[model samples]
Target: MAAKKPWRIIPRPLLETILNNHAQHHRVPQPLLLHGPRGVGKTTLILQRLLPDWNKGPHLTGYVDFAELMKGNLGTSPGPWASWSTCPQPRLSDCRKILEHCVESMVEKGVSAGTITSQQIFTTLNKWHGLTAALRHVLQSKSRASDRASPAALWERAVFAMSRECTTAEVGRILGFGENEKNGLSFEEASYMKESVAALKLAKKIIALQQGWRANAITHMNRTGLFSRTLTHSCTDWPCLLLEFLSQAAEIDHFQPKLVINNIEVLKHATVNSESTVSGPLYHDSLIWRIIALGANERCLPVILVTSDSYYSYEAFLEFGYMEIFISREVSVEGLLG
Candidate 1:
């Protein structure tokens, strides 16, 4: 082998295209799809190059790897509905799982990876102190739960460590929040931690209602069906609370938001029908970016570049005669409409 290069190759054209699009587009920039052979440094280029540049810009940035999301179990097993063997439907539960996993990935990797530290994001949340009520509940619940060493547990610990304020009072004591990890977070780190913890807090709430996490909450929320639909985005145009958190954080920072979603191919495993009929020219991924992008203008949203990469990029390009794929997303929000 030639001298093993421990570095990544940035495709200059691709980088320039992404940069120009971000610079030019405002108010709901569409999704850009990347296509190439496997192991061709696509994901590497995104993490090593694209994310660094975006994080440095005036926008907030986050990276979600679908394959990694699929691998993590967020305090629950893959139920029959989500079991990969069944090729389950594209349910909100899967989306909820994804949102949860996305938070985990950001919180765990963001500081080290330096993808979520927008100067504006840091400025917006710098003065936030005290244990937010939602964070208190999440930490208290984790403190009370069994199996204190799972990945979920470790993630909770890490979040607690990152988010500790000056006073390690009652709630902080529950998770040892302010014991040893104070006086170290920079303004950027503090801002990212505030938003990330808030995102995680909201993700937990969504999961509670959407899934059977708390039977009583479901019992009451599902009884009305209206409350259920509102929480789960069944009848609402708003996307997941986590997505909202991302947008709101970026908006507060006054920077446009950019989300790099890798491996759309992994979503094939989570489709509604087990048939080979799902993947085609028209299958707009309704789960994640599509919902956020569609209502961008009406929502008074900043220009959020929600880019994903899959083989569909090439197929859509070939069919639509476009070099890069920027298409709308279509998802069903049918229930609780009454």
Candidate 2:
């Protein structure tokens, strides 16, 4: 990976601490929404700077093009319920197909087709090696797969696909080609087909772990941009799900704090749509918030949030709960980079 350009300015003290804590612990908190005007970089802060800090270890971090995913499902885009329905249930197999085709195309296009007798090519070699290598490594190692498949083995055939620079689009193309390939296909076709199968199997395994079926009622199925009303109905059981997950985590891993969820407006919308109030302030409504309040009351989990601008309603929430230390300042780049 290359060094990224520095951010325009330093991060606020409050943002720094929250991100640090999230990085230190593995759990993402749901109350930390930084709400304000558009230019403040609320989404950029969480999606780019904050979430990367939060996901320090083997945790997977990537954004799905929710707009595209929604459009494909609903035959349109920018609908109120786009994120709710389409975002949750991702077609893992289909995703793999698209990714595989992309890689294949990059490999083939990088060099002249059958130009070199020493390195003659037959098909499109989409340059998606880096991404494919990373993903394959994760699937085989970080997740503890029973079978260990090598990257070299996955890319043995270079007829249509070559081994070269891999971009996001290349990944998509590789999967597409694999799905569209015919039987007795070339190396590229076979590799992509294999990828599709593997992705499906992995998706099934993850879904099974979440619940008995492919769709989980809570966390796995919840989308970030859901309409307040639709989201509330869909995630009505989130409180119980979150509680259950936390309890399970507590039982299995006595490790440090884990995962912090930033940008909690999504949760707020979900709660409001469900016709539930978060209680005492912040206008938060949900079983999870209630649980957090109980914990805060007992001095268990300390809840916090970052804001682009101050909202008196949030101050009221803390006051009603008799909770002190609910606020903090932002941090500088020196503090974060170090």
- Give the alpha-carbon lDDT of every model: 0.40, 0.33
What's each prediction's TM-score?
Answer: 0.43, 0.33
**Error in Å for residue 303 of model 2:** 7.0
Which regions of candidate 1 deviate over 4 angstroms? 1-11, 23-27, 57-59, 69-99, 103-178, 181-203, 210-239, 252-256, 271-284, 288-338
Task: Please tell me which predicted candidate would have the highest lDDT against the true structure.
Answer: 1
lDDT value for candidate 2? Answer: 0.33
Task: Report the lDDT tens digits of candidate 2 across residue range 1-338.
Answer: 11132333444666556555544432432323333432455445656665664334333222222223334455554543334433433332333233233322322222111111111111111121122343343345334433454433333322122222233344334344444444455776545544433332232233233332223333222344323432332222322222222222221122222322333333333222222222111323443355455354322222234333233223434544533323222222112221
Q: Against the correct fold, how does model 1 do in TM-score? A: 0.43
Candidate 1: C-alpha RMSD to true structure equals 14.6
- After superposition, the stretches of candidate 2 with alpha carbons farther than 4 Å from their true spots are 1-14, 26-37, 58-237, 247-284, 297-309, 312-315, 318-320, 325-338
